[model samples]
Target: ARQLQKILKLDPKTEVFLKRVSLLLTQIAAGDFGGARRRESFEDRPPKVLLKDRPELTK
Candidate 1:
């Protein structure tokens, strides 16, 4: 955060906003942050393939 503040020359308001976000992340484990989120991965993932209708490319 400090590095960003220095590099971006952030205004006071922006600095405060970043600090709030950092604090929120630190508190996520304690339920202080809003909805919790985390990454998940499947070990036996299926390989990607081209679909018949190009659904993968569109959506």
Candidate 2:
């Protein structure tokens, strides 16, 4: 979670991205990504855009 916190510090909007990445990491760490099923779908938006639209994230 430290890495995710660091990424959040770099760009707070990364919360969503970081969450998804973290989830993926956890799944991979637990050896669950090798199946023929999808875990979850990440938003189709960019972090910068999310930050721009939701400045509250920088807080």
Candidate 3:
């Protein structure tokens, strides 16, 4: 948090800085930064005609 304050040129004692830190902490407590997002993958095979013989392209 100190590093981020330094990077943003924020004074630690100010209201704006305190509000931002509070919001960030609240978001973190709610798992907003957790790496549990869905990933993009081929749910089903691509159209056969578009990639008829390109074996490597399937993935």
Candidate 4:
């Protein structure tokens, strides 16, 4: 989470930053950041990095 804040130039302690990160992780775990139907339009979908930090959610 700290690394994500740094990469996005966000303040790690801020609530907004934390919320956005949480949502991103939720999207990743659900296996569709923009839903399965919309994902088909994406030419390059990156793998979820959150999986490394919270592997259990993938189940």
Candidate 5:
């Protein structure tokens, strides 16, 4: 709507903006915005200091 476009300061990308908003709502409904999910996705790699002490990297 024109009111939404005026409020959002968008030229004619209301459809695009609506699509993004829908996706955000979907993510919220699916609990994808939780911090626990982010923490669980961390890589289980060693620290940089330990990597430097390795025999392969020391060579």
Candidate 6:
């Protein structure tokens, strides 16, 4: 594949990807696929995190 690309001069896909992303963002801005937005309040954070202190996970 690398040799084929070197011979044929393939272009990178960034422009195509960015175009699709911009369209998706436009849809999102117009609420085409919007779900319930979560609160950004600090109180929404969990009171305790359980996974960080697992004794068996210490290396």
Error of 4 at 56 (Å): 48
Instruction: Report the C-alpha lDDT of model 5 over 1-59, residue by residue, as the tens digit.
Output: 99886787855578687888998898889888655755665434545786688858544
- What is the number of backbone collisions in each predicted candidate, taken in the order shown? 0, 0, 0, 0, 0, 0
Task: For each candidate in the order shown, give its overall lDDT on alpha carbons.
Answer: 0.64, 0.72, 0.67, 0.73, 0.72, 0.61
Best prediction by TM-score: 2
Q: Give the per-residue Cα lDDT of candidate 5 at 26.
A: 88
Candidate 1 stretches with Cα past 4 Å from truth are 1-7, 34-59
**Which TM-score value belongs to model 2?**
0.39
lDDT of model number 4: 0.73
TM-score for model 5? 0.38
Model 3 residue 26 lDDT score: 87
Best by lDDT: 4
Better of 3 and 4 by TM-score: 4
Query: lDDT tens digits, residues 1-59, model 2?
Result: 99997755766566777889999999899988855454233333436878899999767
Work out the TM-score per prediction. Answer: 0.38, 0.39, 0.34, 0.35, 0.38, 0.36
Overall local distance difference test of candidate 2: 0.72
- In the range 12-31, model 4's lDDT, one tens digit per residue, is 56768689899899988988
lDDT preference between candidates 1 and 3, better one:
3
Which pairs of residues collide in candidate 3?
none
Q: What's the distance in Å from true for residue 42, model 5?
A: 13
Name the better of 3 and 6 by lDDT: 3
